[model samples]
Target: MTTNKSQDSLQQQLASLPQDVQPGRDLWQGIELAITQQPSATDKAKPKSWVYGAVAASILVPAVAVWISISSLSGPVEPGLDSAALIAQLSEQYESQKSSLLVTYQDKPALTDNWQSQLTELEDAAAAIKSALKHDPNNVALLRMLQTVYQQQIDLIERVHAPKWQQI
Candidate 1:
């Protein structure tokens, strides 16, 4: 009797169970649906990426500004012309204008009058170039040319006006 009862229970359990041992299509579909609905790690990292972007911008802005400042301060440099050449060119122009400059002046009683003013302008320009030469002693060609121009200007002025009252 016991053996028959045991067999009957086993048969009832087997009838209640599903035929397939593996999961159904609905179970696999539910698992895939749940995984697809979850949030990704990249979405959480967006704010961190923005922070890194800010850091990069902060560093780049100052570097660009410093580069521009340096470039502007130096200005453009010509390959052939140095500071000495610039001084010589200015001195040449000064000498070329000396005759016309003196003629424009009229005889006046005050020492500060006509000729004096023109001389003063030439003197100032020469002084500035001389000062620049002191800082750059290597440009011998420019230095020699400027000295010659300055000496010539002085000699011409002395030769032209010998009598003090004739100039007056």
Candidate 2:
């Protein structure tokens, strides 16, 4: 009879507790939204790829333009040697030859002042031969005559001036 009384008291305590303690929502609907609302993997890379492509094109276009402009500005043809260059070369040759002849004359001061005229004529002849030689570098007769004229003028100046350098 005591066991029966204890069992009754336990049942009465359980019946007195509250029954509305659990929270509620639609779990299936939440799972469907999470799975269906995400963007596709293929859609994520398009804008970044286009941005990189546009930047590369922008850099390449200006680089090609600059290269073309510089190429055009420099032009495509080689410049030819003009008459001034030839004349300057002849003048240089004449000066060098005359300087050598003048030194030779100065070394032997016994030469006549009249030899100056002959020296001038030899210089003129050398200039003429140089002009001709520019057109034909292999003209043997012209070169021989040019050398002969040069030597003749030198010999004449040496005869009129002091003895030859070896003799001195």
Candidate 3:
């Protein structure tokens, strides 16, 4: 019963309100004036030069810093430090190390049967990189990749032959 009375009161209040009430003044005139008026030069949005400069500096400063650091670290190449010679020297060392490791592990069976295949794959990759280096003997990236592959092969050989349990 109380809900019904409250609902009736709400309906009465809604009915008493004017449905078609008009504004005291016509709003279109003000709207039209605002729309037709040109914005003042000062009111128009301007690109802030300092903000752009700040943004550019934020990007450019780090880039320039990185380039400078890299250039400084690399320094000028020494005439005697030939890439081919370096590659050859490193390859000789790697082969010697690999041979020694194989000899050390010759009596031990590898933990994984597929380790030799994996090593073969790495050797293939190394061969490809070396071939690439031959075409571009001065390529540092290729040299690094070849070095990494050789290291990986060595690591794989060591890990498979010398299982962690055996170390303990």
The lDDT, on a scale of 0 to 1, for candidate 3 is 0.75
For residue 157, model 3's alpha carbon misses the true position, in angstroms, by 0.4
Maximum-TM-score candidate: 3
Instruction: Quote the lDDT for 130 in model 3.
Output: 87
Clashing pairs in 1: none
For residue 163, model 2's alpha carbon misses the true position, in angstroms, by: 6.0
Q: Summarize candidate 2's per-residue lDDT along 1-168 as a digit string, tens digits.
A: 899999999989989988776548758888899888878776774466676677467435534543443343234323452434434543444345446556755765654567778777887887787678679654545555555565566556556664446431
Cα misplacement distance, residue 45 of candidate 2 (Å): 99
Question: Least lDDT summed over 10 consecutive residues: which range in candidate 2?
Answer: 69-78
Error of 1 at 34 (Å): 99
> What are the per-residue Cα lDDT tens digits for candidate 3 across 121-140?
99999999989988977665
lDDT of each candidate versus the true structure: 0.56, 0.58, 0.75
Candidate with the larger lDDT of 1 and 2: 2
Candidate that scores best on lDDT = 3
Worst 10 residues of 1 by lDDT: 104-113
Residue 30 of model 2 has an lDDT of 82
Kindly list the per-residue Cα lDDT of model 1 for residues 22-97, writing each as its tens digit.
7555587778888888668767645666766774575355445434433432545545546555455545544554
